[model samples]
Target: MFHKVVVTLLVVSAAVIYADVYEPVYKPEPLPYYFNYNVYDDYKGANYGQQEKSDGKAVYGSYTVDLPDGRKQRVDYTADHYKGYVAKVSYYGKAQHPKYYGPAVTFFNQYGNGYH
Candidate 1:
Protein backbone atom coordinates (compact mmCIF):
# COMPACT_ATOMS: atom_id res chain seq x y z
CA MET A 1 0.00 0.00 0.00
CA PHE A 2 2.79 2.46 0.87
CA HIS A 3 4.55 1.74 -2.47
CA LYS A 4 1.36 2.43 -4.40
CA VAL A 5 0.86 5.72 -2.53
CA VAL A 6 4.42 6.80 -3.27
CA VAL A 7 4.02 6.05 -6.97
CA THR A 8 0.80 8.04 -7.12
CA LEU A 9 2.44 11.06 -5.47
CA LEU A 10 5.35 10.90 -7.90
CA VAL A 11 3.03 10.79 -10.88
CA VAL A 12 1.00 13.72 -9.62
CA SER A 13 4.14 15.75 -8.98
CA ALA A 14 5.46 14.97 -12.48
CA ALA A 15 2.23 16.15 -14.02
CA VAL A 16 2.36 19.42 -12.08
CA ILE A 17 5.93 20.04 -13.16
CA TYR A 18 5.14 19.24 -16.76
CA ALA A 19 2.23 21.65 -16.77
CA ASP A 20 4.47 24.44 -15.50
CA VAL A 21 7.15 23.59 -18.05
CA TYR A 22 4.80 23.90 -21.02
CA GLU A 23 5.17 27.17 -22.92
CA PRO A 24 2.72 29.01 -25.12
CA VAL A 25 3.10 29.07 -28.89
CA TYR A 26 1.95 32.62 -29.36
CA LYS A 27 2.06 35.74 -27.17
CA PRO A 28 -0.93 38.05 -26.90
CA GLU A 29 -0.95 41.85 -26.83
CA PRO A 30 -3.36 44.70 -26.36
CA LEU A 31 -6.13 45.27 -28.93
CA PRO A 32 -6.17 47.97 -31.64
CA TYR A 33 -2.53 47.01 -32.06
CA TYR A 34 -0.67 50.17 -33.06
CA PHE A 35 2.77 51.55 -33.81
CA ASN A 36 4.72 54.79 -33.38
CA TYR A 37 4.59 56.32 -36.91
CA ASN A 38 7.50 58.63 -36.20
CA VAL A 39 10.02 55.78 -36.68
CA TYR A 40 9.47 55.62 -40.50
CA ASP A 41 7.83 58.82 -41.72
CA ASP A 42 8.81 59.81 -45.26
CA TYR A 43 6.98 59.85 -48.57
CA LYS A 44 8.49 60.33 -52.07
CA GLY A 45 5.36 59.90 -54.17
CA ALA A 46 2.00 61.69 -54.41
CA ASN A 47 1.36 60.36 -50.85
CA TYR A 48 -2.18 59.61 -51.84
CA GLY A 49 -4.61 56.93 -50.62
CA GLN A 50 -6.11 54.58 -53.24
CA GLN A 51 -7.75 51.42 -51.93
CA GLU A 52 -7.54 49.59 -55.28
CA LYS A 53 -3.83 50.35 -55.62
CA SER A 54 -1.29 48.64 -53.40
CA ASP A 55 0.53 50.80 -50.84
CA GLY A 56 3.77 48.91 -50.98
CA LYS A 57 5.89 50.78 -48.47
CA ALA A 58 8.79 49.04 -46.77
CA VAL A 59 7.36 49.04 -43.28
CA TYR A 60 6.68 46.55 -40.50
CA GLY A 61 2.98 47.38 -40.35
CA SER A 62 0.72 49.97 -42.01
CA TYR A 63 -1.19 53.03 -40.85
CA THR A 64 -3.00 55.74 -42.85
CA VAL A 65 -3.13 59.29 -41.57
CA ASP A 66 -5.21 62.16 -42.90
CA LEU A 67 -2.73 64.97 -42.80
CA PRO A 68 -4.03 68.50 -42.73
CA ASP A 69 -3.25 68.40 -46.48
CA GLY A 70 -5.90 67.05 -48.86
CA ARG A 71 -3.87 63.88 -49.43
CA LYS A 72 -4.45 60.94 -47.11
CA GLN A 73 -1.31 59.43 -45.56
CA ARG A 74 -0.62 55.68 -45.57
CA VAL A 75 1.99 54.02 -43.36
CA ASP A 76 3.40 50.53 -42.74
CA TYR A 77 4.84 49.30 -39.45
CA THR A 78 7.69 46.78 -39.31
CA ALA A 79 9.41 45.13 -36.40
CA ASP A 80 12.70 46.75 -35.51
CA HIS A 81 16.03 45.24 -34.52
CA TYR A 82 14.19 44.07 -31.42
CA LYS A 83 11.96 40.96 -31.47
CA GLY A 84 8.70 42.68 -30.42
CA TYR A 85 9.15 45.37 -33.07
CA VAL A 86 6.72 44.21 -35.78
CA ALA A 87 7.40 45.67 -39.22
CA LYS A 88 4.44 47.12 -41.08
CA VAL A 89 3.47 45.09 -44.14
CA SER A 90 1.40 48.00 -45.53
CA TYR A 91 -0.68 50.84 -44.24
CA TYR A 92 -4.41 50.86 -43.89
CA GLY A 93 -4.52 51.67 -47.61
CA LYS A 94 -6.84 54.42 -46.59
CA ALA A 95 -6.50 55.04 -42.87
CA GLN A 96 -10.10 56.22 -42.93
CA HIS A 97 -11.21 53.13 -44.82
CA PRO A 98 -10.56 50.60 -42.09
CA LYS A 99 -12.97 48.37 -43.95
CA TYR A 100 -10.64 48.13 -46.93
CA TYR A 101 -8.01 46.72 -44.57
CA GLY A 102 -8.72 43.71 -42.41
CA PRO A 103 -8.13 43.56 -38.69
CA ALA A 104 -4.55 43.86 -37.44
CA VAL A 105 -4.01 40.05 -37.78
CA THR A 106 -5.08 39.57 -41.43
CA PHE A 107 -3.65 42.98 -42.42
CA PHE A 108 -0.21 43.47 -43.92
CA ASN A 109 1.28 46.73 -45.25
CA GLN A 110 2.46 46.47 -48.82
CA TYR A 111 4.76 49.06 -50.40
CA GLY A 112 1.68 50.51 -52.03
CA ASN A 113 -1.92 50.00 -50.87
CA GLY A 114 -2.53 46.58 -52.36
CA TYR A 115 -4.22 43.95 -50.20
CA HIS A 116 -2.92 40.41 -50.50
Candidate 2:
Protein backbone atom coordinates (compact mmCIF):
# COMPACT_ATOMS: atom_id res chain seq x y z
CA MET A 1 0.00 0.00 0.00
CA PHE A 2 2.81 2.44 0.86
CA HIS A 3 4.58 1.72 -2.42
CA LYS A 4 1.38 2.30 -4.36
CA VAL A 5 0.83 5.64 -2.61
CA VAL A 6 4.41 6.78 -3.41
CA VAL A 7 3.99 5.83 -7.07
CA THR A 8 0.68 7.66 -7.33
CA LEU A 9 2.14 10.82 -5.76
CA LEU A 10 5.11 10.76 -8.12
CA VAL A 11 2.82 10.37 -11.08
CA VAL A 12 0.65 13.31 -9.97
CA SER A 13 3.70 15.55 -9.44
CA ALA A 14 5.13 14.65 -12.86
CA ALA A 15 1.78 15.37 -14.52
CA VAL A 16 1.60 18.80 -12.90
CA ILE A 17 5.13 19.67 -13.97
CA TYR A 18 4.39 18.55 -17.53
CA ALA A 19 1.24 20.65 -17.68
CA ASP A 20 3.09 23.73 -16.43
CA VAL A 21 5.83 23.30 -19.04
CA TYR A 22 3.32 23.07 -21.94
CA GLU A 23 1.01 25.93 -20.81
CA PRO A 24 1.09 29.08 -22.95
CA VAL A 25 1.43 32.63 -21.69
CA TYR A 26 0.45 35.73 -23.72
CA LYS A 27 1.29 39.44 -23.15
CA PRO A 28 -0.06 42.19 -25.37
CA GLU A 29 1.89 45.36 -26.20
CA PRO A 30 1.25 48.30 -28.48
CA LEU A 31 3.44 48.68 -31.58
CA PRO A 32 3.59 51.90 -33.58
CA TYR A 33 5.30 52.89 -36.83
CA TYR A 34 4.93 55.10 -39.88
CA PHE A 35 6.33 55.31 -43.42
CA ASN A 36 5.76 57.32 -46.60
CA TYR A 37 7.23 57.65 -50.07
CA ASN A 38 6.63 59.38 -53.44
CA VAL A 39 7.93 58.78 -56.92
CA TYR A 40 7.68 61.05 -59.99
CA ASP A 41 9.46 60.63 -63.27
CA ASP A 42 8.53 62.87 -66.17
CA TYR A 43 10.53 60.95 -68.78
CA LYS A 44 9.10 57.57 -67.83
CA GLY A 45 5.64 58.95 -67.14
CA ALA A 46 5.56 57.37 -63.71
CA ASN A 47 3.88 59.12 -60.80
CA TYR A 48 2.87 57.53 -57.49
CA GLY A 49 2.86 58.08 -53.74
CA GLN A 50 2.12 56.02 -50.65
CA GLN A 51 1.87 56.57 -46.92
CA GLU A 52 1.10 54.13 -44.10
CA LYS A 53 1.11 53.90 -40.32
CA SER A 54 0.24 51.33 -37.66
CA ASP A 55 -0.38 51.11 -33.93
CA GLY A 56 -0.10 47.32 -33.57
CA LYS A 57 -3.86 46.90 -33.37
CA ALA A 58 -4.84 49.01 -36.36
CA VAL A 59 -3.20 50.12 -39.61
CA TYR A 60 -4.03 52.95 -42.01
CA GLY A 61 -2.59 53.89 -45.38
CA SER A 62 -3.17 55.57 -48.73
CA TYR A 63 -1.67 55.27 -52.18
CA THR A 64 -2.04 57.16 -55.48
CA VAL A 65 -1.06 56.30 -59.03
CA ASP A 66 -1.23 57.98 -62.41
CA LEU A 67 -3.47 56.04 -64.76
CA PRO A 68 -2.67 55.47 -68.40
CA ASP A 69 -5.82 57.35 -69.52
CA GLY A 70 -4.66 60.65 -68.02
CA ARG A 71 -6.41 60.16 -64.66
CA LYS A 72 -5.18 59.81 -61.12
CA GLN A 73 -6.31 56.86 -59.03
CA ARG A 74 -6.19 56.94 -55.24
CA VAL A 75 -7.05 54.46 -52.54
CA ASP A 76 -7.38 54.86 -48.78
CA TYR A 77 -7.43 51.82 -46.56
CA THR A 78 -7.54 50.60 -42.97
CA ALA A 79 -6.99 47.21 -41.38
CA ASP A 80 -7.14 45.51 -37.99
CA HIS A 81 -7.70 42.18 -36.33
CA TYR A 82 -11.41 42.86 -35.90
CA LYS A 83 -12.29 44.78 -39.06
CA GLY A 84 -9.98 42.98 -41.49
CA TYR A 85 -9.17 45.24 -44.47
CA VAL A 86 -11.32 48.02 -45.92
CA ALA A 87 -10.57 50.47 -48.69
CA LYS A 88 -12.10 53.57 -50.30
CA VAL A 89 -11.24 54.33 -53.92
CA SER A 90 -11.59 57.67 -55.69
CA TYR A 91 -10.48 59.37 -58.89
CA TYR A 92 -9.05 62.87 -59.17
CA GLY A 93 -9.30 63.71 -62.90
CA LYS A 94 -11.22 62.70 -65.99
CA ALA A 95 -9.78 60.00 -68.25
CA GLN A 96 -8.76 60.96 -71.79
CA HIS A 97 -7.33 59.05 -74.78
CA PRO A 98 -5.20 60.58 -77.47
CA LYS A 99 -6.70 60.90 -80.97
CA TYR A 100 -5.84 58.00 -83.28
CA TYR A 101 -4.30 58.75 -86.67
CA GLY A 102 -3.84 56.60 -89.80
CA PRO A 103 -0.98 54.06 -90.00
CA ALA A 104 2.38 55.80 -90.26
CA VAL A 105 3.52 53.88 -93.35
CA THR A 106 2.20 51.56 -96.11
CA PHE A 107 2.55 47.81 -95.90
CA PHE A 108 5.67 46.08 -97.30
CA ASN A 109 6.51 42.54 -98.45
CA GLN A 110 6.76 40.14 -95.47
CA TYR A 111 8.84 37.36 -97.20
CA GLY A 112 12.53 37.98 -97.93
CA ASN A 113 13.71 36.63 -101.38
CA GLY A 114 10.76 34.16 -101.17
CA TYR A 115 13.04 31.70 -99.37
CA HIS A 116 11.28 28.77 -97.71
Candidate 3:
Protein backbone atom coordinates (compact mmCIF):
# COMPACT_ATOMS: atom_id res chain seq x y z
CA MET A 1 0.00 0.00 0.00
CA PHE A 2 2.85 2.42 0.80
CA HIS A 3 4.52 1.73 -2.54
CA LYS A 4 1.29 2.37 -4.43
CA VAL A 5 0.81 5.68 -2.60
CA VAL A 6 4.38 6.75 -3.46
CA VAL A 7 3.87 5.89 -7.15
CA THR A 8 0.61 7.87 -7.33
CA LEU A 9 2.29 10.93 -5.75
CA LEU A 10 5.16 10.75 -8.27
CA VAL A 11 2.72 10.59 -11.19
CA VAL A 12 0.79 13.62 -9.93
CA SER A 13 3.98 15.66 -9.43
CA ALA A 14 5.14 14.81 -12.93
CA ALA A 15 1.80 15.90 -14.41
CA VAL A 16 1.92 19.26 -12.56
CA ILE A 17 5.45 19.94 -13.76
CA TYR A 18 4.54 19.11 -17.35
CA ALA A 19 1.48 21.38 -17.23
CA ASP A 20 3.55 24.32 -15.95
CA VAL A 21 6.04 23.95 -18.78
CA TYR A 22 3.41 23.57 -21.53
CA GLU A 23 2.88 26.46 -23.99
CA PRO A 24 0.49 26.93 -26.93
CA VAL A 25 2.05 26.19 -30.33
CA TYR A 26 0.11 28.91 -32.16
CA LYS A 27 -0.89 32.41 -31.02
CA PRO A 28 -3.59 34.29 -32.93
CA GLU A 29 -2.78 37.83 -34.02
CA PRO A 30 -5.27 40.66 -33.51
CA LEU A 31 -7.11 41.99 -36.55
CA PRO A 32 -7.57 45.73 -37.19
CA TYR A 33 -10.76 47.24 -38.66
CA TYR A 34 -12.88 50.36 -38.90
CA PHE A 35 -16.56 51.16 -39.47
CA ASN A 36 -18.95 54.13 -39.56
CA TYR A 37 -22.63 54.83 -40.18
CA ASN A 38 -25.07 57.72 -40.29
CA VAL A 39 -28.84 58.05 -40.35
CA TYR A 40 -31.17 61.01 -40.93
CA ASP A 41 -34.95 60.66 -41.05
CA ASP A 42 -36.85 63.91 -41.25
CA TYR A 43 -40.27 62.25 -41.00
CA LYS A 44 -39.45 60.44 -37.75
CA GLY A 45 -37.20 63.29 -36.54
CA ALA A 46 -34.27 60.90 -36.06
CA ASN A 47 -30.67 61.93 -36.68
CA TYR A 48 -27.59 60.01 -35.50
CA GLY A 49 -24.14 58.89 -36.57
CA GLN A 50 -21.34 56.71 -35.21
CA GLN A 51 -17.80 55.87 -36.23
CA GLU A 52 -15.13 53.58 -34.76
CA LYS A 53 -11.70 52.21 -35.55
CA SER A 54 -9.18 49.88 -33.94
CA ASP A 55 -5.58 48.89 -34.57
CA GLY A 56 -5.49 45.78 -32.39
CA LYS A 57 -4.05 47.62 -29.39
CA ALA A 58 -6.49 50.53 -29.00
CA VAL A 59 -10.01 51.53 -30.10
CA TYR A 60 -11.49 54.99 -30.77
CA GLY A 61 -15.03 56.02 -31.54
CA SER A 62 -17.57 58.82 -31.50
CA TYR A 63 -21.36 59.10 -31.73
CA THR A 64 -23.95 61.84 -31.98
CA VAL A 65 -27.73 61.85 -31.62
CA ASP A 66 -30.60 64.29 -31.48
CA LEU A 67 -32.37 64.55 -28.13
CA PRO A 68 -36.13 64.89 -27.82
CA ASP A 69 -35.70 68.19 -25.93
CA GLY A 70 -34.22 69.82 -29.05
CA ARG A 71 -30.59 69.25 -28.05
CA LYS A 72 -27.82 67.28 -29.73
CA GLN A 73 -25.84 64.80 -27.63
CA ARG A 74 -22.28 63.92 -28.65
CA VAL A 75 -19.85 61.42 -27.15
CA ASP A 76 -16.22 60.69 -27.98
CA TYR A 77 -14.60 57.60 -26.53
CA THR A 78 -11.40 55.57 -26.53
CA ALA A 79 -10.28 52.29 -25.02
CA ASP A 80 -7.19 50.11 -24.65
CA HIS A 81 -5.63 47.47 -22.41
CA TYR A 82 -3.88 50.16 -20.37
CA LYS A 83 -6.50 52.90 -20.18
CA GLY A 84 -9.55 50.62 -20.39
CA TYR A 85 -12.31 53.02 -21.52
CA VAL A 86 -12.78 56.79 -21.49
CA ALA A 87 -15.53 59.04 -22.85
CA LYS A 88 -16.16 62.77 -23.23
CA VAL A 89 -19.73 63.95 -23.59
CA SER A 90 -21.07 67.28 -24.82
CA TYR A 91 -24.35 68.87 -25.87
CA TYR A 92 -25.22 71.24 -28.70
CA GLY A 93 -28.20 73.56 -29.08
CA LYS A 94 -30.54 74.80 -26.38
CA ALA A 95 -33.26 72.56 -24.95
CA GLN A 96 -36.82 73.83 -25.32
CA HIS A 97 -40.10 72.49 -23.93
CA PRO A 98 -43.61 73.77 -24.40
CA LYS A 99 -45.41 75.39 -21.49
CA TYR A 100 -47.67 73.09 -19.46
CA TYR A 101 -51.22 73.93 -18.27
CA GLY A 102 -53.96 72.08 -16.41
CA PRO A 103 -56.27 69.82 -18.39
CA ALA A 104 -59.03 71.70 -20.24
CA VAL A 105 -62.63 71.55 -18.86
CA THR A 106 -64.84 71.16 -21.86
CA PHE A 107 -68.17 71.03 -19.88
CA PHE A 108 -69.03 71.95 -16.23
CA ASN A 109 -72.13 72.74 -14.18
CA GLN A 110 -72.81 76.13 -12.60
CA TYR A 111 -71.85 74.73 -9.16
CA GLY A 112 -68.29 74.18 -10.43
CA ASN A 113 -68.72 70.40 -10.40
CA GLY A 114 -67.68 68.24 -13.38
CA TYR A 115 -71.15 66.55 -13.51
CA HIS A 116 -74.51 68.32 -13.53
Best candidate according to lDDT: 3
Residues 31-101, candidate 1: write the lDDT tens digits: 43323323323573333332222223222445555553334555444443345455333322332333374
Model 3, runs deviating above 4 Å = 1-22, 101-116
Estimate every model's Cα lDDT from 0 to 1.
Answer: 0.49, 0.91, 0.95
Cα-based TM-score, every candidate = 0.25, 0.64, 0.67
Report per-prediction Cα RMSD to one decimal.
Answer: 16.5, 10.5, 10.0
Q: Model 2 — which ten-residue stretch has the worst lDDT?
A: 107-116
Pairs clashing in candidate 2?
Answer: none
Candidate 3 lDDT tens digits, 1-116: 99999999999999999999999999887789999999999999999999999998899999999999999999999999998999999999999997995766567778776842
Residue pairs clashing, model 3:
none
State which candidate, 2 or 3, has the greater TM-score: 3
